[model samples]
Target: MKNDFEDKMADIMLGEAVTALLDEDVAISWAALTDRLRSAIEIETDEDRIRAGLRAIEEVRREMHVRNGEKTEGKRVAALTEQKLH
Candidate 1:
């Protein structure tokens, strides 16, 4: 028997996972945007600005990868569910 806090945490985790999975297109767009940002960053003359942009791009890439993983997991889950239902 799960406690209320545990149940709430599980729900929150599940919601986050599902939301991440649903934003597959957004993740792909972010990847493209990061690529563009990298190109812009390359031509930047200001060292500080270049470093900041790189940091931001890395953060966004990390998130995009996470979303991509979630999307893959969601697809696998869907496939398994479909197989079970048939």
Candidate 2:
């Protein structure tokens, strides 16, 4: 069905967006990231598909935040260990 195809396209778009986000060598702000997603999704005329893409992007953002927090925590722990050893 057409609806199913649209859903699949949205999923593929979301995957591409997440892959670009993760593959970045330099860090980018959340606002910038969302702005980029919004721009990318602007080409979609279907309201339902747009909303679904946004929801998926939000989930990806949350997961990215969690991963970033974990990385920061690991660095902090390493710093503390080094300080204690000195």
Candidate 3:
């Protein structure tokens, strides 16, 4: 997202992903989100596109994680300990 084009791509893709899930009551899991993006949007499965989309997805995931008061990086994300979640 260092460039405008990458940011725009992430924003547009994120919007589509969010919209694809608006009518459902599915859990907000990463797997669910990825599946929705795959099925609902005709994403070209090129490695670069997948990587870019993953980068965008990580933004949302990171925000949610930080909002839940769990600060982590890389592999530490999965080992999140019980903390005072706001």
User: What TM-scores do the predictions have?
Assistant: 0.59, 0.58, 0.53
Instruction: Please list the residue runs of candidate 1 whose C-alpha ends up more than 4 Å from where it truly belongs after superposition.
Output: 1-28
> How would you order the candidates by lDDT, starting with the best?
2, 3, 1
Rank the models by TM-score, top first. Answer: 1, 2, 3
Query: Per-residue lDDT tens digits of candidate 3, residues 1-86?
Result: 45676777767777777776776766666667767656543556665556557667777777777865654463365544334342
Clash total of candidate 3: 0
Please state the error at residue 27 of candidate 3 in Å. 7.0
Output the worst ten-in-a-row residue range by lDDT, candidate 3: 77-86
Model 3 has an lDDT value of 0.65
Top candidate on lDDT is 2
lDDT of 1 by residue, 1-86 (tens): 43454445434433443455456544535755566557656887876556555666666668888999999999999999999999
**For model 2, what is the error of residue 10's alpha carbon versus the real structure, in angstroms, after optimal superposition?**
5.6
lDDT tens readout by residue for model 2, 1-86: 97677667667767666677778753566665676578777997877768767876776688789999999999999999999999
Cα error, candidate 3, residue 86 (Å): 22
Scored by CA lDDT, what does every candidate get? 0.62, 0.74, 0.65
Error of 2 at 23 (Å): 14
